[model samples]
Target: MDIKNIRQEMALLDDVIPLEGHHYAACLQTYEAASSQRKLILEWFTNHVIPQIPRDSASFLSIGCGAGELDVKILAAAKEQASTIAYVGLEPDSKQCERFTASMALPSDQNIRVETLNTNFEKYTEQRRFDRVLMVHSLYYMNDPERAIEKALNLVNESGKLIILIASNDTLNELSSSFWQMENGGSTWFSEDLSKHLDKRGVAFDRHRIKAKLDITSCCAPESEQGIRIADFIAQAPTGELPPGLRTMIFSYLEATSHLDGEMRWLPHNVDAFII
Candidate 1:
């Protein structure tokens, strides 16, 4: 499907699937499973990357800042350095942004300001430049990722940074096999050669790999319940419809591998943090 079609279908799914308690719980479970991976990704940035960036830079922008988790983390880190950081989050989902705003308890006295825009980054015009622009695990949703990156590049102040954390195509191929098998097809949004694309564009970036391990058995009853709810929500979507056998297989696969036996493994994602 084209970009327009994908957006329409996603909008429909968002309307049809109410992301309430169960959905949030499931997301939390997913987050727990991926916490280590997330930490590693962030650690790399804080230790190796952020030090290189001048703390005096004016602002930081995180595109698709779902639930503002990363925003909170980054802000907390910057606070430790007594950095007067301004944060801007651009999210496509209004509901998610609202939830994030409601739940966040960032330091009020700190020189940190958080603003979220409820619109697609591609269409949302940026009026000001930022010292850092980040797209974490959210770039694949864009209609034209290259154009999105280009726009992100444009939003950066001179000598600013643009960080993109995307799942490598191979990782998607493994984890989303069922998704790819669906007949209610969509265009492959993932870039198989994302690093090359960035290099060709002369975007200087450092790359890292994050390993996400899911252990089904370790999931408590609450977590499993949330997972089931998420599965149901996902299964009901048009793009999520799969042959019965395949669907069953996917669920069974998820159930069987929840214990982190190292049996169920996804490939490392290509995480690129570019200095523009």
Candidate 2:
């Protein structure tokens, strides 16, 4: 399979379908099964970001919080530090919202409140500000990421901050960037572009890079059902729906990008956190 041929095929594809809630959930499951990226993110957030937060009392506004996986851990840290915390999560998908809400059941003895809004940032009606506003890997899918950043920044209190967790252009992007370019008619935002935008706008922010790796051993196997799901996730499409030649190229691309470590394949999966 030719990588160059795959790029040409990806460019020929004009229409891109957004994944349904269930599809996204399945993809996430497949991704996490072979990746420790999110675990690293939680650790970094707890050590680096949480320490900078106010310990007395805090309010958290999590934008596009899906399944509340990392948010719950962050909330636990906040609850441990602060006397009270008012946490609100914004998620548009009902399925992920259900999962997010279910995991957010803190102990009754805790002086914390959790609320989930089944809406995006643009439709959120409350004028309430938060101590920390987070958009963890959600900016890419927002209707307008730049505007969303601006609005999220506005919703932060004077002494508070808006934190954005975005992925960097690692080997993961090497596998998916062509799909994104054809789908969006432009390149998606990576850490470099985000930093450049902030610098050009004279926006002051601190950046933290979390280096990590993804185990794509399953993704490298041709007969692994989980591998197909992960390939779908990487390409953001139904792999079964893809043309045979293109699908072969997709797997070939993955095997090419990943480095062999023992019997497993590892792919670079670094992420960046921007504090505004």
Candidate 3:
């Protein structure tokens, strides 16, 4: 099938498959995994990244910070260090942003000054640059990831860091291989490719790449279980119906994997830490 046909098929699947709750649950599970990863990321930042910074007070901008799992962890760390860190989270999804803000208001020792911006990173502009800018697991949704990276770079101050946590092309290719085979599609976006594209755009940057594996078997329990509650939200068209084959394929895939142990297993997620 042609690329256009593939896109149409995928769109059809998206329409018919009511996977919003599934995705929401999956995101929560992924966030829990990310919470674990956050510890390592924090350690890396504290031992290596933070010391490199020249200032005691740092401003951090996270594009698509999701439910603020990483933000909360980072803010808690800053509290321990007695550092003044300002955090700005940009999330396109209003619901998720609301959840993030609600979660941030919880009692904590972390003197985290958080501001949640309900807007896209590309459309949002800032008068001042940040000490660190990050896009964690959210760049793939962007239509123009290269431009998004440039926009992120523009938000960074001199000697500041641009941190990106993205699934490697290889990892995505592998995970989606079966789905692609079943549906006939190609690969998704990549962090390394984005980095290379950034370099081609005349952006001088460095990279610190790392990989991690997470176990998420507990999250995908039966739908009745409260392990990870995800809403299966499919975008409905005017017809409000999905193609038969597309819907079948998606649900079948979900069913096949629902009971399986979910793990990142060598799924190399590139954490490209760029210094400008």
Top TM-score hit = 2
Clashes of each: 8, 0, 12
60-129, model 1: which lDDT tens digit per residue? 8888887876667777676666367777888777777886676555657556677877888878876798
Best candidate per lDDT, number?
2
TM-score of each: 0.73, 0.94, 0.67
TM-score: model 2 vs. ground truth? 0.94
Q: In candidate 2, which residue ranges exceed 4 Å CA deviation? A: 1-3
What are the Cα lDDT values of the candidates?
Answer: 0.58, 0.83, 0.57
Q: After superposition, which runs of candidate 3 have C-alpha atoms over 4 Å from their true positions? A: 1-26, 34-36, 80-82, 106-112, 171-187, 216-276
Model 3 TM-score on a 0 to 1 scale:
0.67
lDDT, model 2, position 185: 72
Q: How many clashes (backbone atoms < 3 Å, residues ≥3 apart in a chain or on different chains) does model 3 have?
A: 12
* Candidate 1 CA-lDDT value: 0.58
Residue 250 deviation, candidate 3, in Å? 8.2
CA shift of 90, model 1, Å: 0.8
